[model samples]
Target chain A: MKKTKHKILDMLLKHPDIHLSGQKICDVLGCSRTAVWKHIKELESEGFKIEAIQKKGYRLLSTPNELSEARILVGLKTKELGQHLIYFDSIGSTQKETQHLAEDGAPHGTLVITSHQMTGRGRLGRTWSMPKGKGIAMSLILRPKLSINRIPQLTLIAAVAVYKAITEVTGIQTDIKWPNDILVMGKKIVGILTEMQTEGTNVKAVIIGMGMNINANKNDFPEEIRHVATSLKTLTGKEHDMSLIVQTILFYFEELYLRYLEEGFSVIKWMWESHAVSIGKRINARLFNGKVLTGLAKGIDEEGALLLEDDQGSIHKIYSADIEIE
Target chain B: MKKTKHKILDMLLKHPDIHLSGQKICDVLGCSRTAVWKHIKELESEGFKIEAIQKKGYRLLSTPNELSEARILVGLKTKELGQHLIYFDSIGSTQKETQHLAEDGAPHGTLVITSHQMTGRGRLGRTWSMPKGKGIAMSLILRPKLSINRIPQLTLIAAVAVYKAITEVTGIQTDIKWPNDILVMGKKIVGILTEMQTEGTNVKAVIIGMGMNINANKNDFPEEIRHVATSLKTLTGKEHDMSLIVQTILFYFEELYLRYLEEGFSVIKWMWESHAVSIGKRINARLFNGKVLTGLAKGIDEEGALLLEDDQGSIHKIYSADIEIE
Candidate 1:
C-alpha cells in the first residue's frame, strides 16, 4: 500500500545523517530489492535525491522539499491524528481549507497544514505571522460527537497539547494562559483558534486551528507584537526540531483525544488545570463589548467557562474573553 | 450607483401587480431611458426576462427567473440584514459560502441564499433535504459584538422569529421546543442551524442557517422522516409566501437583535419563556454520552443553559441535546 511505502521512506528520511545499503534497506523494509529500488527512483523523481551507485548502495542525498501528500505522510507520527494529511505549500489560510474539508466529510482526525499562508489568521481577526517553513500552521478537522456545550474543551485540549510539545522538544518553559494563548516568559508563543458547526446544541464538526512559532525569529513578528510575541528558537537559543515536536504533540494529542472520547473532560480538564497559569489569581477579563469583569480567577466550571469570584463573593462565569492577571 | 439600478429592477420582479412604461420606469428610477434600458438588458443577460413593447413598456414577466443582482436587491428589505445578498442559484451549501465570506471580512448580516444545494446539511452532519426553489434554505451571517456566553441568544432570537413568521403568514400554531427546532403539533416544521467562529469566548461571527419547509407536500418528506417532520403546506393545506415571511422575520429579528445588544437577555428570555413547551414540564434530555436526565424543565439559567429541576428539588443545567417531554 502507499501508506507502507511512505512509512519506509519516512523512516529513512527521519535519520538523514545515516546511510544504508540495498540489503539493509530491504531487510528493514521486509520487501524485495526491486521494490526498494523503484521506491528510491520514485523519491528521486519527486525531488528526493537518493544516491544509488552499485557498490555504494543507497544514501539519502535530498528529499523533495514539499508539504505534499508524500512528504506529510513521511513526516507525521500519529496513526490517526495526521494520518490523512492535506498539506499546501502556500495557501490563503489553513483554517479555510480545514473548514472546507470538514464540510466535505473529512474524517475526525484529519489535518490540513500549509507551509506558507498568504491569508494567515490569528485570534480576533488579527493577521498571523506565517513565513514559509518557520512554524506549524495547521488545522485539525475533528468530527467530535459532542454537544455544543462541551465545545470549549477543544480549546483547552489544544492549549495543553501545544504547551507540552513545545516544552518537551525545545526545553522552553512555555505556559498556557487561562483559555488559549501559550506564553513563554510572559510573551505569546502560540495561538489557538477554534470554530465549530452545530445545529442547536449538536456539534457536527470542530476545527482546531493551532499556529505555533517553531523557527520564526524576533524580526519575523510584527512591530506591535515584538514586545509580547516570542518563538521557540528565540527562547531556546537554537532551532528546535519541528519533526520531533510534531510527532510528540500529535501522539500526545491522540492519546488525549481518546481520553476525551472515553473519559470525557476529567483527563483534559485535569491536565489543563495543571498546565495553565492563572487558576486562582486576581484577573480582569475584557469582553468583546468593552465591558470588564474583575475577580479572582477560579477554576473552569463543568461547561468550560471560567468562574471568576468577585470581591462580593458573587462568581461570574466568563464564557469567552481576553484575560489579564493583575 | 450600482445599487440604484439593482433596486429599480428588483422592485419590478417581486411586484406582480406593478406595471410600467420605459418612460414611467425612468421617471421613478430618476435615470435616463437609455440607462434604464441598459440595466434591463443587463438583467436579461443575467436571467431576468422583461417584456418589452412600444406602449406597454417594461413589464417584468412573471417567469423571468434570475439570480441577477437586481432580483436579489429588489427582494431584500433591511438596511443591514441583507445589505449585501449573494445568490449562487445553486451551491454546495449557502452556509459554506457565507462562512468563507464572513472570514474574509464580509460585513455581518450578509445573507447567502441559494435556490438549490448539492450538499445541504442539518445538525449532526445529517443530510438536510434542500430541493430547488421549494424551501427557504438560506444562511444569514451575523457579526454580533457579544461574548461567546451571549452567542446562544442568536438561536433563541431565530427560533422566536421563525415561530412568529410561520404563525403570522400561515396561521399555524408553532411551538419552539427547547434549543432551536420549530415544531407544529409535535412534528418539526423548521430547523435552525447556528455555526460560530470564536477565539476563546470572543465571537467573530455567527452564521444562522435556516431550512424551512414551504411548499413541500407530505410525499416530499423522506420516508424515514415522514413520522417526525412536516412541511408548511403539509400542515396548513396552503402554500405560503417564503419571501414575505423572510422579510417579516428579518424585520422582527432586527428589532430583537438590537434589543439583545442594548438590554441583554432580560426581555428575550421572557418571550422565550412564554412559548417554551418544556418550561415546568417533566422532560428527559438525551445527552451525548448516552446519559439521560429526567427532571422538570425549568427556564434557562443566566448563562443560557436549560435548567432541569429533579424530583429531589436539585437543579441540573442541561446544555446541548434533544429534550423529550415525558
Candidate 2:
C-alpha cells in the first residue's frame, strides 16, 4: 500500500539536501514517472514538503513531526529493532496491536507506533493520556532469550535507553524513577509498560510500550495530573521533531539491547543507576498488595531489583510498586 | 452449529436407561419432532446406537468412546472449569487456538480440546504426537491474580492435579516427574505445558495444555518416542474412555485451583512431593542453557521450586529443567 511511497522517501532521505530526479526514482523503484509523481503527491498530503524545480527534479525540504512509518524509517539505523514498523494515524493502543502481532509470530524488532492512542495504558493497568499529535505512543516487540525471573531487568534497561535518548536528542536532563518512568524537573514525561508472553521459564516475546509526551504542552495534560506531569515542549518551550526522537530512541535501544545480550545486565544496571532519581532518597513504596513501606531507596541490585532499606534496617526487594518521594 | 446436537445428546444421556418420547424431547429443546429425529440420526452417524422402539420412542443402547463436547459435558461437575468447551475433530495445535481465544477475552476455564493434534508441542518446544481418537489434547484458560515468579508453582500444581485425575479415573499408578510430566511404569503418559500472558507482575491469562495418551496403542506412537512413551491401553491392555478422563481432570483442576487460591501452594507442594518420582533420588537436570547438572533432588519448597543439592552441598533452585532419574 504505502510501501512504494516509503521506498521513494527512503531514497530521498538517503541523500538529504540533494535533488532526486523523478526518472531516476522511477528507474530504481521500477515504476512509471506518473506513479512516482502520485506517490510524491501522497507524501506531500501526509505532511512532507517536496520541492520541485523546473527541470532539476525533486528535493525533500522537510518532514513533518508526525510519527509516520515513512518518517520513522527515514534513517532508522538498526539491524533488527524497528525494522518492520506499523504506523497508525490513530489507534486504541499500540500495546494491544503489538500483542496480536507477537502472537502471530511477527519477527523481532517489529514496532507499532501511533499518532494518537484513544486508550493508552500505563503500569499497573493505569490509564495514560496521549493527545493526538502530542506524544509518541509506540510499542516494540522483542524476543529475548532470557528466563522469566530476569524480565524485570529489561524494564530497567529500557528506562536507561530511553533516558539516554532523551538526553542526547533533546538535551533535556531527564531522570528515571525506578522501574519504568522518565521524569523531567520532578515531573513524569515518559511512562513504560512492559508485557510478556512466556512458556514456563522461556519468554516467547516481550512487548515494551512507551508513551512519551514529546510535543505536548502544559495544557495538554489532564487537570489531575497537570501538576505532576510534564512534557518535552513544556520543559524546553520548543516543539521537538518526533521522528528524530524516535530514531534516537530506536538507535539507543538496539545498541543497549545488543550490549545487554552480549555482556548481560551489569552495564545496563550501572547506566540505570547513574540516571535514577530515587537513589539515596527517603520514599514510601505502595506495593501491589496495598501495603506501604517507608524506606530509603538504596539503588538496584544485580538483577535490577530495587533494594529498599526500611527503618528497621531490613531491606526489601520491591518487584512491582508505586513509589512516593518524601 | 453443533450446539443443538450437543443439547440433544445431553438430554439423551440424562435419561440413560429410559425411553423418552420424541414429542417430549422436542418440547424440552424447543425444536420440532422432525428436528429431534434428524439430530438423533446425526448422533447415530457419530457412532451412537439408539434403539428405536415402535411406539415407546428412543432408547440409548450404547455410546462410542468418543471425546465429543456432549460426552465430556454429560456429567461435568465443576464451578468454573470446562463450563465452555470448544471441540475439534482434529487441529494443528490446541495451544495455538487457545492462546488466540485467551487473547480475545475468553473467560477463565474455557477449554479447547481436540481429538488429535497434527503438530502438538511439548515443553521446551519439543514435538508431541497425539493420534486421532486415541488421546486427549486440550488446553485450559485461567486468569489468576498471581505474580510471574509464582507461575512455576501453577505448572507443579497442574501436574499434581492431572496425576490425581489419572490415578482416580483409570486406577493406574502414575508418578509425577518434577515440573509437568506423568510417568507410569517408568514411561511417559502425560505432558503438561503451561504458558502465561503477563504485564509486569499481574498475570492476564495462563493457558495450560495437557496431552495425555488415553487410548493409544503401542503402534500409535512414533518410532522415536514409542519406547519412552506408553498409553493407558498399552499398559492396561484395554481402551479407556477419554470423556471420563477429561471430566475427571477438569473436576480435579477446579477443586485444586480453588484450594490453591484459598490456601496457597503448601497443600499442592505436599501432594506433589508425595507423587514426585525424582525426590530423594540422584537425577540429571538438563537446563535450557544446555547445562546438565547431576544432583540429589530434594522435595520442593513452599513455592514449588525444586531443591537440587549439587555435589558441593549447595542447593540450586531449579525453575525449569528436564529431569531424568539416575
Candidate 3:
C-alpha cells in the first residue's frame, strides 16, 4: 500500500542528484513497473514534482513542505528513531495513537506523526490548536529501562533535544521554560508532554508528544493565542522545510537519548540549565494544590526538580508546578 | 448483550430467599414475559438451577461455582468500585481490556472480570497459570489524583486489601511478601500487579490486576508450580465461594483506596507491615541489573520501598527487585 510508495520515494530521495530507474525500483520493492508508475502518479498528485526522462528514469525534483513519511525519511540520519514512522494526513491526537500502538507492542523509536490534529492535547488535560499542515504534531515511543522515580528527567531531556534541534535546524535560539515549553522571544514556540506506562517501579514505555509551530503565520493562530504563540514562519518571515526540521529533531533526539541511557542525566541537566530562562530570576510557581510560592528560581536538583529559594533563603524542591516569571 | 442477562440473574439473587414473579420481573426490566422466560432458560443451560412453581414464581435454588458478573455483583456493597463491570466468558488478559477501556475514558471503579484468562500476565513480564473457572482474574481501573512517586504504594495497599479480604472470607491467615505477593503457609496464593498511565507527575489511571488461586484442588495445579503455588481449596480442604471473595476484595479495596486518598499511606503502611512476612528475616533480592543482594529485610520506607540492611549494617533502598526468602 502506501508503504511501497514511501519506499520508492525513499529510494528516489536517497540519490536526489541522480535519477532512479523504474526497473530498479520494481526490483528493490518487488513490485511491477506498472505499480511503480501508478505510485509515481499518486505522488505527483500529492504535490511532489518528479521529472521523468525517456528511458532515463525518475528524479525527485522537489518535495512540497509536507510532513509525509517519505519527506521526513529523506535525510533522517538516526539509527533507530524515526526508522518506523506512521504518518497520518489527519488524526485526533498523536498521543492517543501512540498509546494504542505502544499497547499493541510497537517497538522503541516508533514515531506517530500527523499533519493535523482535531483535538490536540497538552499537559494537565489542556488543548492546543494545531492547524493542518502547519505544525509538527508527533509522538515518539521510547522504552527506557529506568526506574519510575527518574521518569521526570525525561521531560527535561526532551526540552533540551527540542532546543538543540530548533537551534541547529533553523538557527533559532529558544529558551526552555522550566519543565518543557520552548519559548522564542518570550512566546511559546513548542510544547513537550511526556507520558509513560509503568508496572510498579518498572517503566514499560514512555510516549513523548511534541507540538511545534513550524510554518504557521501570525494569522494562523487563534485570537486568544496570537499574543503568546509564535511559529518559525512568523519569527523568520519565511517558510521552512518541516521535513528537515523533523529529521533534525529525530537526529538530535536519538543521540541525546542514547547518551542519557549511557551516562545518566548530568549532560541533559547541564544543557537544560544553560538555556533555562527562569533560573536566577524571581518567579512564582503555582502548585497543583492551588498554592502559589514566590521565590528565586534556582537551578534544578539532581533529579531535575526545580529548586526555588524563598525569602528565607531555603530551597524548595518543586516537583509539579506551573512557573510564572516575575 | 450479556449485561441484561446478568441483570436478570442479579434480580434473582437479590431475593434468593423469596420467589420473583415473571410479571414483576417483566415490569422492572421493561421486557416481555417471553423474553424473561428465555433468559431464565439460558441461565439454566449455564448451570443455574431455577425452581419454577406453577403459577407462583421463580426461585433461585442453587448456582454453579462460576465467576459470573451476576454472582460477583450479588451482594457487593461498594460505592464506586465494580459499579460498572465488564464481564467476559474468557479473555486474554483483564489488564489489556482495562488498559483499553481506561484510554477510552472509562470512569474510576470500572472492573474487568473474566471467567478465565487465556494468557494471564504477572509482574516483570512473567506468566501465571490461570485455569478456567478456578481463579479470580480481574482488573480494576482507578483514577487517583496522585503524584507518580506515590504510585509504588498502590501495590502495597492492594496487598493489604487482598490479605484482609482473604482473611475475612476464608479465615485463612495469609502473609504479605513485601511489594505484591500474598503467601499462605509459605506458599504463594495471590499476586498483585499495579500499572498506571502517567503524564509528567500526574497519574491518569491505575490498573490493578489481581490473580488469586481459588477453588482449585491439589490435582488442578501443574507439576512445576505445585510446590510453590497453593489455593484456598488446597489449604482448607473445602471449596470456597469465589464470588464472595471478589465482593470482599472490592469492598476492602475501595475502602483502603479512599482512606489512602484522604488519610495518606500511614494506615496502609501499618496494615501492610503487620502482615508482611519478609520483615525481620534474611532474604536475597535479585535486582533488575542481574545483581543479587542478600540482607535482612528491615521493613519498608516512607515511599513503600524495601529497605535491605546488608551484613555491614548499611541499608539499601531496593527500588525494583525480585525477593527470595532465604
- Best by lDDT, which number? 3
Task: Give one digit per residue, the lDDT tens place, for model 1 in A1-326.
Answer: 35556865776776677677778878877889888878777777656677666765766776543334576566566778987777676788898788767765689888887657778787777788765677778888777776566888888888888878777766777778878789878888788888875545556678888887777788887788789887877876777655566666787888787888898888788888887788888999997668999989888877778889998999998876789989
Interface RMSD of candidate number 2 = 1.8
For model 1, the superposed segments whose C-alpha errors exceed 4 Å read A1-5, A10-53, A60-77, A145-156, A185-187, A217-227, A234-237, A257-326, B1-6, B9-19, B27-53, B56-72, B185-187, B219-229, B234-238, B273-326
lDDT of 2 by residue, B1-326 (tens): 33677787877877888998998888888999899899899888877889888678887887777776777876788877988888898999899889888866799999999887898898867888977789989999999988777877888888888888888877998999988889998999999999999887579899999999988889878888887899999999887778888898889888888899899988888888998999999999998789998899998887677899999999998887888999
Q: Which stretches of candidate 3 lie over 4 Å from their true place?
A: A1-11, A14-32, B1-17, B24-32, B42-46
Docking class of 1: acceptable
For residue A90, model 2's alpha carbon misses the true position, in angstroms, by 3.9
* lDDT of the structure predicted as candidate 1: 0.76
DockQ of candidate 2 compared with the true complex: 0.56
Q: Top model by DockQ, which number?
A: 3
Query: lDDT ranking from best to worst?
Result: 3, 2, 1
- The native-contact fractions of the candidates, in order shown, are 0.57, 0.72, 0.74
Q: What is the DockQ of each candidate?
A: 0.42, 0.56, 0.68
